[model samples]
Target: MSGPGTNGAAGAPLLSIEGLSAGFDGQSAPAVQGLTLSVKAGEIVALVGESGSGKSVTALSLLRLLPRSAWIRGRAEFVRESGEIVDLYSAPKGTMLSLRGADISMIFQEPMTSLNPVFTIGEQLTEGLRLSGATRGEARERGERALAEVGISEPGRRFSQYPHEFSGGMRQRVMIAMALLRSPRLLIADEPTTALDVTVQAQVLDLLASLRETRGLSILLITHDLGLVSRVADVAAVMFRGRLVEVGPVGEVFARPAHPYTRALLACAPRLGAPRKRLMSIADILAAGDGPFGRTGRSPWMPPVDGDSARGDGCVLEPVGPGHSVAVVEPGEIAAGAEPAT
Candidate 1:
């Protein structure tokens, strides 16, 4: 059943979030505050941020999977396969239950922990279908097909083995297969390649891209790897201190980072074939008298008279280019000689 919200018109966003804030009961500050983002149909949008920057919180909030102590306030609109729009935050329990796995599925980080060690892979893989009313035999047959689809060989034999019997990469493939059993329209992958070798990571990423191409899947990829963002993501949204700092097409954001924080992050990333240099910390950039971008004077992106105001009420995302937005203070508030480039 569709909830109250705007319909998803053709070429409109598959998912849109605005002014989202999530916080635990005891926290003086929210984990995420005033976050806004969109994921178009058949697009891969990477939510990029450092640890504890609210990326994960935003994902959990979308699914309404946070602990009871967590309070969330926001508008999260998702377009269903039927083209009806649903407000995820307010969707009924039954609606969410039907939506999860069938319309939207998640691949969590660390498949080892996500998989049930006590259950055989086949049992676990088929559980969702079984619960959804498929017969045991039907579920098993579909499960095997899913295993094969994810590039696993000898699916029937592998399905009978427990999670502990598989290698890390194989286990990850299993997680992918499980998430795909229902053929979800949107896949939320939270660090899907964590702890894998570079080769395995590439394989998993390739698998995701292939799925997107073949199934017209929209993906919300939550990750800290800028390299990964550059490789597979069509769009990138950067979060800092629980707030969105920059968002745009992957190529544009990478080429011209408008915000100081965004520039600091790019500087910290290790570039191929570049000369070795000490990685600059975000703190270092903030403390630099001349600012992180090597401007002639202190950067306007730095905190003004009030320290927190830099990311607080005074900050807003200004369009620096087509589809590219950066959080910055107004021109009048910027320090002399530290204005952002037009």
Candidate 2:
């Protein structure tokens, strides 16, 4: 898998995953199993899943950023900025590190962990820029410009400040600035606006969309926020038990979801600032053979595949239309065909 597709700018997918499975330390079950998706050039693919659904892990594995204790397997094909295809799963360390923070950057959920408090924000930003071949003076100027581009105010003043000195939204802007310093071809933003207020969230989301369009940046956005995904993502993939339960164009999936799980997710959302009614929510842990998507692995935590589930009751994903895929419950199943496996 040295080179599988055209370069990132060649009007093709920049990243592709096939049969990917990842397991954390001390767990026999994979946090994610048999996951697959692709990010076309200048397109944003949202990996939407709740807590423990392996959304973040999937992103982390792409750059081989997962801990050594974690076990990872399967195909991870990527096109570099130079337009060479490579298998990210087994990429050489030197090559991977070179691409990281330069060709492809990630803005993780927690800013504090991603940024070093000891360093000034400007220093943190300039460091990456300079390392990527910009002169020190150029790095400083570019850093300020990037911050301003993300809608941060008083960019010059903020550039000299430490991470703690900035508000949450400002800090996130700085993170974006750092991520975009080298104008990476692919950007992986994991829960970029999780804790921000609504107004700022909207602004940040808009900035992301704008940047993607203007810079022609391919992106893989991992988040549990359906609202954010609905706002910025071009394509959507719903994951349950480490498998892609549904995937398609954002508009298509959002308006007419084919998977039972995705439909349930929409039903669970608070409507137009409406308050939620008390009800038993879906459980977090899903067992294989217990849902429509079957176990692609040998773990109980995986959703059941069609016709192969324990009770022979679960369903698997089937392609619904051209370029659109989703899971559906099969006919004549347990619960009298009242399939809970969506």
Cα lDDT tens digits, model 2, 65-160, are 899889898998889867788899998999898888778899988765777889999998888667667897888888889888888888899889
Task: Return the TM-score for candidate 1, rounded to 2 decimals.
Answer: 0.87
Q: What TM-score against the true fold does each predicted structure earn? A: 0.87, 0.83
Show the lowest summed lDDT stretch of 10 residues, model 2: 1-10
lDDT of each: 0.79, 0.74
| Top TM-score model | 1
Per-residue lDDT of model 1, residues 169-261, tens digit only: 889999989999999988999999978988898888888888887888888999888888777888889987788988988888899787666
Show pairs that collide, candidate 1.
Answer: none
Model 2 local distance difference test score: 0.74
Model 2 residue 128 CA deviation (Å) reads: 2.0
